[model samples]
Target: MKVDAISNDTAYYFLRQLGLERFNVKNLNAGHCAKARSWESKKAKGAWSMSRYAEPDENGEVEGVDGQNNNVAYLSRSNGNSPTEQLKKIGLSANKFTFLRMMRGSTLRALVPYLNKEQLLLAMRLFPKMLLVRLIGSLPKDMLLKMILHTIPLKKFLALFKAKVLFSIVANKRLNVREMVNGLEHLPREELQRLMTNITGSDTTQLNKPELLGMFRELDKLQLMNGLRKMGQEHFLEFVYQVTKKDPQLLMALPRGELMKVVNSMPKPTLVELFNLLPKSQLEQFVSMLPYKALLVALYQIDNKTMESLLVNQFPDLIAALAGDGLEAA
Candidate 1:
């Protein structure tokens, strides 16, 4: 006489509706009373009825069930408890139960639009576990449920839900290692260094080149290059090479200020040599940082109008560099 053994869809429908605010017990089939009585008779002398209308146990706690038989038994045996009280004994809040019951009658799709993005994400994560548990628990008395239940703990099922959420968030490109690193900034320096090392080593080996590149792109978007640079030349060069190899265009598109900072930090002789090697377009961008005296000296050596045109016409950097030095020296 297990409640689950009953296969009547009408019976389940009638019981599920008990949670509904407007649902009336009087509307259920009259024959359900005999079924409820049979269920009650199966219980041991002092065993609790699934219907909670009877007196509570030694702990003064009532247990209730949801379904037509239990609802019918509750209605017949009530010691003046209201329907709301009866529903509460079964661990369901009146309003939530009402919504659940309504969902059974109407389409659940209508309720989906009302859920926010976070709520939707939460549902997506939890629903699968819920379904899995139901599936495992509902296996026939063929010992399948018992065997599976022994092997899979409920906590593992919950962990699977969290793993699913993480996978979904990461798979969609909305989350990545760099963002995760930035989030851990407040941790100890040693912890941060260890975390970065582990992430870089594992990601570089575990992920394909394209996936690693996307991760680096996310890091750049989060402005974490400075932190990466601070990690040391070896780490920085590795990072730079990885990024540059994947996207040469990104280096060309770097912000002028950041590019200047990187250039200025290089050794003076190397900086000068690198500056000389840049294309005319890139070289023109550095006109502001070039020492005016150095330019004037270099200008005398150049046989081209490009140098003169930049120095005479667009030389704010040249002017500032020159002005910073006395006219006597110029």
Candidate 2:
């Protein structure tokens, strides 16, 4: 009974809790899944062996296989001889730490051939999500697209790529969109649609001129505020007018500091309306990073009661300044 639904931990847990039925990825239905363990798999045809988890320590430290060494003694006494016995079975000549480090340096391309069908199915679970997404964003479009095509655990890869955390990181320029988009293109139409929805909050089919124009216009505004060629106040206002014609959410692509800069420089009415469009949680986070002048300017927009509530409810330290004649007094 190969079960597709119980192919992950969350699915297994939820189903078993709801019914008295335990499930696992390897054998959701016993005798159904044909996957085998790594040890039982045939040796890799290539020189790069995934089963051969060993590397020499550069520091020249050697650990004895006998139970005399403290670590080895503990392993022998507690976990029994399974790990060391397994190492001997595989002819690996390295300590546990060295073996772990080798796994750390292992690449999917080089290691895939050595994985049994079971390991291949579960392989995506091991990726360091944030680190890999950041790295993927930096890769040239061609390279990133290729990796996405060959990657295991397509579900996790898609989930990580479509995560809001990845979106924010990309917005702050920690990840490049062009490379991200190129990689996204390799996804099937369904996945590609989901990614666009995560990013734009609209169906891919619904994205017409407004979304694209809004995004490009906002990027241009960001470039002017912090790019090579700067625009004057009048031109910025004109651009802001164009941006206001669309959605303010797109402007969120700007770095936090740059977002504040844009707010500080905008006309009073525009600034007030712009902040209104911001989510309260995100706005409060940005407020915490605001410079004294920008924060002071923002204070003038809200009422004394709202400001007092903010001081009392969230920013207690600002209460001293709010109560006093000026910030310098606090």
Best by TM-score: 1
TM-score of each: 0.18, 0.17
Give me the displacement of residue 318 in model 2, in angstroms. 66
Off by over 4 Å in 1: 1-16, 19-168, 176-178, 199-330
lDDT of 1 at 35: 32
What shift in Å separates residue 47 of candidate 1 from its native position after superposition? 54
Model 2 alpha-carbon miss at residue 304, Å:
71
Where's the lowest-lDDT run of ten residues in candidate 2? 321-330
Give model 1's clash tally. Answer: 1
Clashing pairs in 2: none
For residues 1-330, write the lDDT of model 2, one tens digit per residue: 211111234434433422313222232222121121111122123322333332223422111111112343333332443432333332221111112111211221222333333322232222233322442344344333333333323333223232332234334443333433333233345443443454445657655544443443434323322421232333323333233223333334434442233223334333223233333443343333322212222222233344334323332211211112111110
**Each candidate: RMSD:** 36.9, 29.0
lDDT of each: 0.31, 0.30
lDDT of 1 by residue, 178-284 (tens): 54343343344444444345445542434444444455455543344334434543333333334333433323333333323333333433323322322343333
